[model samples]
Target: MIIGYARVSTLEQNEALQTDALDKAGCERLFTDHASGAKAHRPELDRLLDVIRDGDTLVVWKLDRLGRSVQNLVDLMNLLQSRGVGFKSLTENMDTTTPGGVLVFNVFAAMAQFERDLIRERTNAGLQAARARGHKGGRPSKLGDRERARIRELYQSRALTVQEIADQYHVSRKTIYSSIKNTR
Candidate 1:
């Protein structure tokens, strides 16, 4: 069975072109999604995956219509291959059933991995630079030194529960615990 999947970003966008292409490509079953490609969940796509089985080919009008990101596309491709299902993209002329197609898909997957590594490297470098300037990341601490000291004093006295100290400072018990951890 050849199943087709089509998507449009919003209700206002039309999937007619995609559907038409899939129809022309001899898709026996079709699923349509009226959600953004970036969205993690698509009910129609999920349903299509649930019903598809080995020897079935999954077709999409374009690569972008089938995935939220390059990594997502690569992951999906690997999943389909593991399930013994083939993948075909109309625009990219990708067909996992062929040797050339498999090579192309692997190249795309490698590129996605390369892109992720570059992003991770750049982010680490930027953080290192910021640290050199004494700039810290993450949410600003809610309580100051006085508040932390008071919390420690109250905690040592055992007169107040951690929750009580947290309520007084408008912070979480975890914050109180962290303060305690840092103090000691």
Candidate 2:
């Protein structure tokens, strides 16, 4: 069984072209999603995965239609391979049933891993540089010393409720409570 999957980032984008290609490729059943490829959950794709069986082939119009990143594509391919399923990308002319296709996918996975490592290295370098510059990355406190002291005074005097203080300060009740704690 050849099962087809199609995806577009937004509802404004049409899936007709992909559907046509899948149909031409002789897909017996098709699933589609009109959502960003970066999203973790895609309903139609999830359903397709649940329905596809071992010995089945999963077809897509293009590689990007199936995944947003190379790492994601490699992960999906690994899953399909482990399940004894084959994968085919019409536009890329990639068919995992062939030796050449497997080689190509292996190369792609290596490149993806390399890219991830580069990104991690850059992020760590950036953080180290920022620390050297005396930069602390967390959000600044909402209340300063004067505001915290006032909040504590108001609470001690029994003049204002936590919710009232929060409303007056344009913050949450939790923030007011924390401010009171800081004063003590």
Candidate 2: RMSD over Cα atoms?
Answer: 3.0
CA lDDT, candidate 1, residue 32:
100
Over 138-180, each residue of candidate 1 has an lDDT whose tens digit, in order, gives 9998888988898999999999999999998899999999999
Clashes of each: 0, 0
Model 2 whole-model lDDT (C-alpha atoms): 0.93
Roughly what TM-score does model 1 have, to 2 decimal places?
0.94
Top-TM-score candidate index: 1
- Badly placed stretches (over 4 Å) of model 1 are none
Candidate 2 global TM-score: 0.78
Tell me, by lDDT, which candidate is best.
Answer: 1
Which parts of model 2 have CA positions greater than 4 angstroms off? 8-17, 34-41, 153-159, 180-184
Question: What C-alpha lDDT do the candidate models reach, one value each?
Answer: 0.94, 0.93
